[model samples]
Target chain A: MNLMLPDSGLLFWMTIIFAVVFFILAKFGFPVITGMVEKRTKRIDDAIGAAREAETRLRSLAQDQERIIAEAQAEHGRILKEAAEEREKMIVAAQEQARAEAGKILEEAREKIQEEKEAALRDIRREVAVLSVAIAEKVVRKELSTAEGQKEMVDRIFDELS
Target chain B: MRKMLVIFIALLTFMAHPVFASGSSEGEVDVAEMIFGHIGDSYGWHITEWNGHHVTIPLPCIVHSSTGWHVFMSSKIEHGHEYEGLFLAEDGRYADKIVEIGPDGSQVRPFDISITKNVASLMFGSALLLIIVLSCARWYRKHDALEKAPGGFAGLMEMMIMMVHDDLIKDSVGPDHRKYAPYLLTAFFFIFLNNLLGIVPFFPGGANLTGNIAVTMVLALFTFFAVNLFANKHYWKEIFWPDGPIFLKCPIPILQVIEILGMFTKPFSLMVRLFANIMAGHAMILGLVSVIFVAARIGPVIGGSMTLITMVFGVFMDCLELLVAFIQAYVFTMLSAVFIGLSRQGGHEEATHDN
Candidate 1:
């Protein structure tokens, strides 16, 4: 058989069947599968990008929390220091004022005690003057009756007063 | 068990074929004619013959003679019989073809377009490819390709599809490959499927469709058009006035002549390569099997050695033919891709400058 020369009939049918196959496949088969694969890749990429953004936000939030707590702790320490300093200053001022008040009261009490002692000395001196005058009257009457006895009494009283 | 049994019977037929062919007519076996007859296209699908009873599925025969049109089943002209003066020409220019007696008593061929064994197998192969590819495509439509991976036969088809579409065709066709993917995928699977089917020795197979020169010619023609039609200006320029030394272009245009010849020869080789490889494979297996009958003609001692030839060497050749089947299909598609890719290449000067 002459195998090299292509027959007209087989060649005709081959062309028709191959063309039909190509048309159907190009229209419905290939594009759908390839397109779906592309879409799936894109979705996966988008999902991964969103996950990365969320992780970054979470990490930043943790850092912010740490910074805020540090700041609050620093503020708390400063306030406590300030309050301690204030309390120390108040205590020192109160001690100084109490010492001054105690000194002032002591000075007033000393002054009052000097004035009461002076008044008490003046009343004792007056009572003593009155008692001496009554004794002198009685002695003068008795001495006139007896001149020698009165003279001796007056000498003894003058010696006692001296 | 049944399939093995069929094969054993077929082996018996192969042994009996020469005896039957010689005994009936010429008193000697023509081994070349016998091998060619098995591989060649026929109007009837010969299943088998047992006890002189020929069981065959007859196909329709259509022909247009110089006289008029005639259409009939091949069974109408069985066993050297004539239906409307048309019969299987036994010995003439168009031997084994549907022929009518010319006025000069010579055999004459008409314009024929019948459903031969090869054509029917072609239909079967193409239809099978359609079912497989379209079914996988439907599966892709039903489920998300990314979310749910294809399973079973669809999965197998996808793996093969990606290899052809992405790996082979894409790499070969360069960028703008998507435009060319459909033809390449179909051609690859078409050749592959037919090659596998051609190796089967039973019904629905055994029709060497790809081995037919006419069939491969049609396939090569498709690639031939795809390459030339879509090619850019630079591609044509390379073919007509190729980039070479001035001497090669001038002084009888040696390079230009070579380039032009290369274009046609590229596709021509594609057609011949597939046809010759498959045709040779079938012929080799037939030759190996026929050795047993040749030995049976001799005495028992050498007959045993000849049986050893068909047994050990024949099986080896069959296995090799199976490997050759896949390789030839792969080589055909790969070469087609390369040729088409070469035709679509841009200017090398521009390419070098960009780099």
Candidate 2:
């Protein structure tokens, strides 16, 4: 066969077929394949977004944990401070209570000592009156018989003393 | 019997003598004889003067005394045209007006063109398209349980589909290609079909459909329209305004104009690259074949060896042409995809007023 260019009939038909085929393929085949690729890409991006969100959540959680820890530390310091203040108050209260009790005891001891002294003085005075009465009775029995003799003796003693 | 034998001897003597040995002859041919031959010349071909141009239109490859070459004009060329041009040279070579040479001398002059044989390429392209499309349609109609992978023809197509899906769309156009996958597949198969048809040895398959500047221009135009129309604000902004210091887009007035021009030229470059590669291959092959004819005429001693060597070289080039056919198709498809990819960037879509 001679090697020559083809006739126009071939070119016309080729163009017709080309246009028709492109139309059909464009409508159907392309969409299916592209859909798959798009799905895969979307899936990947979603995965990345999820991961990013998770990371952010984790960071926030860590921050929250740190905040809680700080609050607990502050609370602990506050409690310790309150406990120290209460201890000082309790010590002061206990000291005041002891002083009041000592003052009451000393007042009672002084009253008891005063009462004992009064009692002893009362006993001594009774003993002294009894000794004076026994001496007078013995002297009366030994000396003067009558009332007159006794009266004269008393007058003589009084005059001698003056 | 004696008369017939003398006539036979005379014929033999005439054949033995080389007519071109000397310009002076018993028959000194005139101007008409040089071009059209004798007025009653059986061959139905002739050259006519058109603005001082010797336009020779051929009617048939096999010219006869009665039926010469036929002429055609641009007005005669149409969408579905069927015509042939033939010219007979004194050297016994039939010159057909096939290639159009451009005014630039360097450029292949653009003119009214037609595919010489449309039926062959059309049939080939249609057959390929029909086979693939119909088979897929049949498979879908049957609604067979979806296989994890493809089988037979479906399997083979599936593999290519997968490659385009994973390698091309997923990689180049990104995952969002689900929306555009159909375009990519159609583009790939369409170009592939034409490429294969082009490489076929004879008939319609070799019209260089994909290589034709007009065809490539159309393809590029589609991409240009598609990309620009669908382009998001980000894609446009990056090209024109850009996302840096205002100075980077410096000499603001000049840069803006340049940026706009770049957008138009990108698609133009795509058109030229594919057309040039395909056309260059044909020119090279033509040059190689010309060598054989030229050498053959210079005496068999040198001619025979040179023709043999050239044919061997020609065969090597033909093999290379096969690789090129696929590469060109791929390049065209890939570039189109890249353009589309650009359009989808940054999520905001812009529509052009043109279809």
Candidate 3:
């Protein structure tokens, strides 16, 4: 078909068509498609965010567990040190009591031995005095029997004694 | 009153200009000279006999009286006579007449009442507009139809629609693409039609619509309207008083003015790029075709070989011109979409980053 070239008349009609078509499309067709696309994008972003948050929470929990284990181990070490100190004190008190009993027994034995020594020394002194007296008596009797002169001297001694 | 003044001045200028006032008769003078200079003594319009490829107009004839001179034309023109006549230049600036003779002894006369350069361009543009809009309407009508439905014109339209959907709207502008697909598709078809028509060999379909600055300016203006109308407050805020450091927020008055100017300049550039490419191609073809004539004036032997070489070369350039037409159309469409996308972008970043 041989078409007529558009003059000012054609241009005016073209502008009308252009405006009407664009206006209709912009109002109806565009919004529906755009809305669907935006919804899909937001869903993806939400899923990604949730995954990241889960990963961070897992990491923090693992760190907390490690710290708790370290604290418990330190408490265990402190209790063991306190028990060892208590045992050492009990052993030192037992050794001191045994040493005091041994010293008292040794003092009693030495006092008994000093008493026996005193008694034995007294008995020896008495025996020596008695033997000296008996010897003096015998010597006087022998001298009287032997001579009349001796009897006269004895009478002089008795007058001196009275 | 002001508009009236302007129109009055333009009218005076048009009347004062000898060309338009002379009517169709005076304009035929150039057509006669162009014909005789090329063809030699074989064909005739009314007069039966030709003396050395020239036909002299009868004295006191409408063609001579009105034109202020008698026209002598030739018959056996080398190119063809089918495309021969006078036309009003697109901007009403210059007048041109050309004739061509095809090899089959046929003459192509370039006379059509309704096919001025601007009118021809407008028609091609409208065809493109019709194709895009009607096809889109058809697609919507058959939206719920089976995937393996019947195919013909609708199928061809589907290919173009998918290309715009995937390549242009989807890739360049991102997912909000659906919102502006119609505009982008319209621009691509409109520009493509005009560009292709501009490169056709003869009338009505031969004016470079996209190459004309006025056509491009109007296209840019459409884009400008779309951007501003659909734009969020964020887009305007960033341009006028952009979020930044306190110093930038203070806003140098001149800087704000220039920022606004940049919006207009961007579309202006789009117009110029398409216009220049099309104009350059046409001028190149005209120059090469002129060469054969220039060569023939020297002598017969050189002229024959030169004509053959220049015509072959000109054909090669015409093929390249076809490719350029599509490229320019795509570039203009892509740029317009990019601008719209830039305008419609969300405000989240501007608020959070102060940028």
Candidate 4:
């Protein structure tokens, strides 16, 4: 029970020892420990921040890639459609030009056939007239001994000329 | 668990051997004296009894008086026999203290600064604290890097220090925790180490430094000063002129008086709480061990059975004491943080209101 009482000697020593420990720990001990802990915490925070930034950047890059791909696909489709339309227009125009050239050649052939027919008719008419004159000369020579037939033939030719 | 078991077996062997060795020559055991002697501070370090011979390490007795400083080995006094005019007081109010024999045959109390058992233990604990903390601090300085993890003793200590900073100081002291963390960390580790060391019951462990009132008083005093000295004007105003009804202040100033008394009681409670808890723990364990000897007064068989049962219970109590040691240290530091935080609250409120 008497041990419960405080002793001056022990108290003095306790105070001295405790004060010395407090000063030493406060100055040399805690700062290093707490500083290190805080530094570790800050490092972790910075790492996390960097990771988050990288994640966002990756997301944006993916989005940009998707956009670019979509635009290229759309441009490819438009170019293909335009080429198909132009090819159809050129095919139609070539068909129309070939038909017009064939019609012009057929018209020129018809004019040449008409001119040759007219010439053939004129030649046939001339031959027929010569044959008729030769027959008439033979009939006159046999009939009246030539004087009366020659006078008739001369009269007919003069009438035709008038 | 295996270590605990070993300690238990060794302790049983030591206790059982002493009884049989002494045998028929044994005298009656003074249970009170035995228990108190185990728990109380002494001038020498008592190890254990062997072959009927008691082993103890005598410490130095240093005293100061009007005459001069008297220094000598405590063995010179021979456990109450006087030597060179100095003696241990055996009776009256100053019992167990070293007193000087005056020329007139009167007992004169000198200013004793002896390195008693408790003081030596305190010094031992201090040395350990210095060695561990300083070495860890040095190691941290050498391998200082923000991203690196701590290992071994430095890692263990860093975890504890971080706990004190984040949980105790930051939770209680708020933004100003940085200013108070160093002191709080020192107090927490110091008390914690001493508490753990006190439970050892052997060379480096038996000294009950934290159980001593003087030591607890000094610890509480540090908290008291830190709280009061750093308090702002608003804190003083709130204490002296609190917001309340006018009638309460006019007649007897009842509220003010209570507030004033509260300031002293807070630290006083801190002192008593730590001292009583530690001392009670040591006493309880000693009392339980003493029970076996008391039972031996009956018969051999019953005494033997009682010894086994008590020994088992003693082991359980020791484990509990280990837990209590940590609890007491934590409670002391947490309370200190709370008191300091409370003192700083007024200033924070005033600052916010002004803004």
- Best-fitting candidate, measured by lDDT? 4
Interface RMSD in angstroms for candidate 4 = 1.2
Q: Worst 10-residue stretch by lDDT in candidate 2 chain B?
A: B35-44
Candidate 3 lDDT, B1-355, residue by residue in tens: 9844543443333222222212323323243333222221111222212332323222111112222332333332212322123211222211122222335644332322222335434655565656555655555455533324325765565556566656877777655677677677767777777777666543335454565555566677788887788776788986887655656446456656666888888887886787678767766765566565557567899989997897578667766777888888888888888888878776656656876
lDDT of 2 by residue, B92-166 (tens): 122232322235532121222332332334445756776785576455445432323336876567667777667
Candidate numbers sorted by lDDT from highest down: 4, 1, 2, 3
Candidates 1 onward: DockQ, in order: 0.52, 0.11, 0.02, 0.62
Better of 1 and 2 by TM-score: 1
Best-fitting candidate, measured by DockQ?
Answer: 4
- Which of the predicted structures, 2 or 3, would earn the higher TM-score when compared with the native? 2
Q: Between candidates 2 and 3, name the one with more favorable lDDT.
A: 2
The global Cα lDDT (0 to 1) of model 3 is: 0.56
Which prediction has the highest TM-score against the true structure?
4
Error of 4 at B263 (Å): 0.7
TM-score, first chain, each model = 0.66, 0.68, 0.42, 0.65
**TM (B chain), model 1:** 0.89
Instruction: Write model 4 residue lDDT over A1-162, tens digit each, in one string.
Output: 466578899889999999999999889988878888898899999999999999999999999999999999999999999999999999998888888888888888888888888888878788777877777666666654777776877888899999
Give residue B295's error in model 3 in angstroms. Answer: 2.4
Model 1, B1-355: lDDT tens digits are 9955655554555455445544433335567776787788889887765555666899988888767888898898888888887888887668788888788977789888988888889999889988888888999888867787788998888778777777788888887688887878788888989987887776788787888999999989998998889877688899888888998888789999998898889889999999999988888877876666667667788878888867777666656766887788778778888877887777556656777
